[model samples]
Target chain A: MVVNGAAIEFKKVRKTYGNFVALESFSMNVAAGEFMTLLGPSGSGKTTALNSLAGFTDITSGDILIDGVSIARVPTEKRNIGMVFQNYSLFPHRNVLGNVAFPLEMRGVGRAEIRKRSLKALEIVRLGGLAERMPHELSGGQKQRVAFARAIVFEPRVLLMDEPLGALDLKLREAMQLEIKQYQQQIGCTVIYVTHDQGEALTLSDRLAVMDKGLIRQLGTPQDLYDRPNSRFVAEFIGLNNIIKISGSKHDGAIVDGLGVIRFPSEIQPSQGYLSVRPEHIRRTPTGGHPAIVRQAVFLGDAVRYVVETRNGAELTLAEPRSGENSSLDPGSEIAISFEENRLIHLPE
Target chain B: MKNRPTTLLLLLPAALLVGLLFVLPILGVLSLSVYGDSGFTLGPIRELVGSRVSLVVLERTFWQALTVSVICVVLGYPAAFFMSGLSTKLRAYLVYLILLPFWISILVRTYTWIIILGREGIINRTLAAFGFSPVQILYTDLAVRIAMVQILLPIVVLTCLASMLDIDKGLVKTARSLGATPTQAFVKVFLPLSLSGAATGGIICFILCLGFYVTPALLGGRRSILISNLIDIQVHQSLNWGFAAALATALLIITLACLALFRLLTRGRTEFSSLGVGR
Candidate 1:
């Protein structure tokens, strides 16, 4: 299918409610057909960004452009944007067919055409057999599917989802995450999805923007964010990582306070910054590594997680996969943990 | 099932009050309609059917009530919609304003209408000052209707407002996002959801208008006399207790029938069905 998706750009968009800044100088460019997720906790302005793009709330300054044309003055109806709310927002009085056909009806499409397209959209969402069922009769997952069908039925260029799967259970949420990605790919529409769920964002987004305090802290692919997070917030927010403080740095090595000098790869600049290492990247050895006392060892079914305190008093978490040779260690056992110099990411101060 | 007796015991006081004060009096009136001095007779029914004045008064009462109710709904619905959109603090103040006249005695309100709509009332004086004729508005159907609408307006507005407020605001936003203009969103989504409330308010106003006594008696002319005024004439001037009891029974039956019809129409309404947020 040839998807006529439009590229969207936010140019220094700032929004404020009185003195409370919901978005401050926010700017991002989403390529056509790219699924970009704005992931953040509540009060981080991700929803505000989505709402502003959808024309629900006007920005205090700057502009939003779709396909290189400014739509700052356009109203929500004329924006030609599809939106699925977290609560589903299906019309209760309308059955599945009527709800999906509403946008086409509003556009003054013929009754026959509306029915055809509505059923087709329902089929896209895998809810084709439920056209006669009212919104109240449907389960939570069905309601959200109907909402998704209604949003895409009109062939909107940009699909904005505001935590659409937040109400579903974990298993259903995971299932819908893959479904949403597949649907976005099939439609070829630029999708701006907002959610606080890190796993969902990573799973569904082609590129994800991590937002904090009305600012985009980091924007990149999921692997880039995971392997090389730019800041302490992104490193901690994405996955389990141990951030070791570096007391000093030289051209070839960094001096950790508790541990001795640690060598870095030549490409990595030895600066006065923290070193971040993933829990799974740390290796447990018998000797010839940094000595640490195991503080806690948790027996997860697939992996054993160890919280070890180094001789310098800094705490580190290491995850060891369950294997035949590597046995689970107790809390008071002395262990030597080695870090892969290449895997160690240098974060600026 | 085990708590049924306790439930019945708790409801006993209300049931006894209704049986004594309401049901017994209505039953007495119904019995009085059939019984004569000697024995049971259909004389009151025959008289009610035969009297041209009573027929004319009954017809007038129905039409006037219907018209007054339509006026109240048309005027009250928009007022209620406007109030629903206000901030909570402002809406509370507006609610107090709408209910201010309700707190006053109906007699006092009717008297105030007479003062405002009389020949030398505020409206005519203002018209005369603007170089217009001083229209005779008092003791007319128009006078009665004006007074009735003003008195019954607050109830209609409040009911409509209550229903409008119950609608989830997300539905409107969703409609708008689905390419509906503001007006379209309201007509297609908000208006349909709020119609049940408006219907309830209109039915109440219509029922209240059917039983109106003081407003019509005080503000209407001889030609504009409603069924209640005719019932009064039967009891006092004609000294016909049977005919008066029959009229009372008819009014009671009509009000109950209207309530039943309203119930039937609104039964199983899914006005709030779409409001399930699933959270």
Candidate 2:
């Protein structure tokens, strides 16, 4: 009912692109200075939510409040929110200085002050020497930095990024991710970043809302979603997991199921009657528990992913460390399966 | 390195055509403008500068062409922007509407203008039916300007619209998100980005206006005679090839100079290469 430091609130926001609904009664609270990511696949209303906050698109119904003020009728310019597009929309005609000075100019800052502020922002993004260079002259990474400098020069209320790093190569993308995160922290600017890359969302966001089919499947910290996913979709989407469809209920310590009674000491009861376990938590046993056959084993650098066949005829994935010669398991080799009961998570069916 | 021969071969046909038609004729004209007269003298060249009639007609021609070019650019930019903002299907339909007049013969278009601006044309008839005396609208400077602008408007609009389409909409959206009003965004970003195309269009319109004869002759009485009309008068009525050649050479030289100035203005800022105006 209560959230801390949440300056922006979306109260049942809905957006419809003609007959098809883009976002349906979506609601979330973005805390001030908290890096929140709207994590979802395409058509999942993640962008719709970010656009509503950015005022690029209108909401069919409901109110979006920023700092407790309703910004529903506010124009995009008046919203004073910086946005970095996927393509890094730098003004091609203007030099780097002009691009960064644009927002300050729009605010009616004096010529000298705009220059000072623009230079400062450029310096903040570590692009001081490239102030006079045109956008086309800069590399992709430098262009994004110019975009970032232009964005934060005016000190907007909230920074919304719609897959800003989607255009960069993997190596550059990871580097920019860290740089932008540090920049956000240094400025203490509240940011709402939208990305489909689960790794990006997990690495950058303080909290994230995983969306599916225009609905928020779950909202929590990265570890919370990964370790204790509230829904089956969240567990499957967040990270690699061995999600077994076990009919179970909360018992003394964990959910009791027909195949195996995985125990947990958690005091809360899971209502949906399911248990989830991370792939690393489940291990192989030698002939005591349920009999499973190794279907496939992939040797990663330090990790091996195994596709094992359980006795009840369900396939489950198990991950183990590559420690010795026995690390690689042969397919069709009979083995037993057991899970770390203490690390099991019980979710609603 | 290997791309050079292929590129040159690809351009061979156009290069040959330019050499045969444009370069050769221009060279012949230059030689004739001097040599066709007595002893390759500068007498005609000197007379061109000293003659009050030639100077007056040349000045009027340049001013009229400049005015028409300005009007075309001013009117065409907004029209092009509106066209570019349209949906693909609607834009295609609108482009067809613009090119409809272009496909019609320029002589026909000039005559159509004559029908509209003549003493007993639709406008005068309508005014007469309203019990007002018919105004003398035809054979005036205004008629010539209107006709020239109407004939050349499509070029300006298409040129500007092409460039406007090439502009990334994301830049405008980014400007708006940075707290710029739509007007500011257009003026600061879109306007500057589209300048070279607009300039190219303006220069083309100016050059085309320089050699305008049909519209001015059909629409104007005497004072509105441009250099092209004067050249026609010298050749047909006066039968003076030397003076006509001199005027044609002047028009060519002035047009090229204006184009050079335009290129200088747009150099390193915005390239109008897509407009194909360089050739």
Candidate 3:
């Protein structure tokens, strides 16, 4: 079955429980067939936002639209959405085929057609041979596969997943991430994925919204957020980042605590907040620049990570790609390092 | 797991206590019913089968137990469902409320039923004030059933509630998201999962009802006597110890038969006991 994804809109949604606010003026627009992810730590309203879209939780005041029609008052079952939970909540009493065929049965479809479509969905998840296995008889990964087939069996235009891979081990989780991306592409459903794992968000999302404290801190393509995070929270949350405090304001140069004053490029003003830099952007040299002593060095198969202390006592981490020409550095060895000017991201507090 | 004998040894004390206090008395009663002057005779059994009053009382007891069990399950299941949906704190208090009446002695509670249903009792007096004739409610089959159901409702409700609590609430949410209406979700998912637990509660209520003597003796008429009451009559009024032992042994067999039947139906299926009910 081919399902053209629906466009979802959350307009000024705010949800509160007595005194605690779970979501505040939350809003976003998801394009049809786009894989959107909500990435945040626990208690960051990422789950509340997903629950609001699924109609599992009532919004205090707002409108949720699917395909440009209001669904604020629509009941959950009438919304015709599919969801996969963290534990893969397949009915413990139902077999794999019975679970996958549940949506069709709920819709009063013909028996033969339900069986045919259910088997087809299982084949998509590559579990056609285990259709008759009860849920408890299957392994964890097999249960996850059944959950995926059950969610997409009816060709729902919209699909929601709440940390669907949180229960799997690390290696299996990475494998399922690739399979999930493929399934979403094949079904062409507008997917809303919620997770706290930044790596999983980066790997599977076409576009993502980084949320914190009941608000969306940043929303853009994965590359956009990774390259240019607008706030301190997003910059620190996305990947390994080095944020140095800017002590004083100066257009040409800024006083940074521990590290002495540093000069900025022409037309770039200094902000009295912090300068965000990636570990790879800092390079080590044999001479010149700031003199530093390597405090620690570890090889990570593809790269060598160095944590060095500057002459002014500022600690900075650097990642150098491993190659034949550059030898690994040892701890307590004297070295020189410099930050790339173009790669520096300055944020005003 | 490495010391199997030691683990088994831990069960010896409780097993011995149960054997001494429970199994020995049951053995004594069984032997008395069969071991006649001729040694291992079936004379008591023959007499029991031949007696007309014993057959009629046994049938009445079976039907009464069946009706009461069905009523308890039908009525108590919904109450348990409503309780399961409540907040944990409120549900805890409500569970206490349901069990509060149970702490009082069964005889005391049964006597209260007499005051509520007697000829000059609260119900008949209320009917008389409304210009209706006072109805005879005490010393009748209805009076006995009403009191029996009242005394047994809590057990059924509690058993049903325990299994309901074991269910993951996420399954219901998943069902609704998969396009099942709330009612459909309950019928197709929740009901089947909890059916075994409810059946377990029904069997327990039936077993307890079969051996009941207090409520029937106090509230029932001559036509409403059960198996236990017949054994009471055989011992007290007729002064027949051997015949009473025969009656008691027959009741024991029927109760054990119901239990064995339940075990047979649920032999390979461990979900009911696995939920930690009846523990």
Q: Please, what is the TM-score per model?
A: 0.94, 0.92, 0.95
Position A71, candidate 1: lDDT: 91
Clashing pairs in 2: A272-A348, A272-A349
How well does candidate 1 score on lDDT at residue B169?
92
Model 1 C-alpha lDDT per residue in residues B1-279, reported as the tens digit of each score: 657998779989999999999999989989999999988999898888898888788888889989999999999999999999999999999998888887789999899988899999999999999999989889999999999999899999999999999999999999999999999999889998899899989998998899899999999988888999998998999899999988887787878887898898778665333222110
Sort the candidates on DockQ, descending order.
Answer: 1, 2, 3
Please list the C-alpha lDDT of all candidates, in the order they appear: 0.89, 0.84, 0.89
Compose the digit string of candidate 2's lDDT tens values, residues B1-279: 667988779889999999999999988767666775456766556667777887788998999899999999999999999998999999999999999997889899888877888888999999989999988878988899998899899999999999999999878888899999999988888998898789889988998888887888888888877787887887899887667677778878887888888777767763321111111
Candidate 1, after superposition: displacement of residue B162 in Å? 0.9
DockQ of each: 0.45, 0.41, 0.40
lDDT of 2 by residue, A1-349 (tens): 0122338999999899889888888988888989999999999999889888888888999999998999999999999898888898988777788888888888888877787888889889989998777778999999999989888888875889999999999999999999999988888878999999999999999999999878899999998888889888888888887666555455644434435545564776443456677879888776567678899989888899889877666777889887867658689888887888678876664
Model 1 Cα lDDT, one tens digit per residue, A1-349: 2368899999999999999999999999999999999999899999999999998998999999999999989999999999999999988777788899889888998877788888899999899898878888999999999999999999998999999999999999998888989999999999999999898988988899999999999999999999989988889889899987787876668876577678876565565778889999999888799899999999998999999999988799999889775668878999898998789887775
What C-alpha lDDT, on a 0 to 100 scale, does residue B135 get in candidate 3? 89
Question: Which candidate wins on DockQ?
Answer: 1
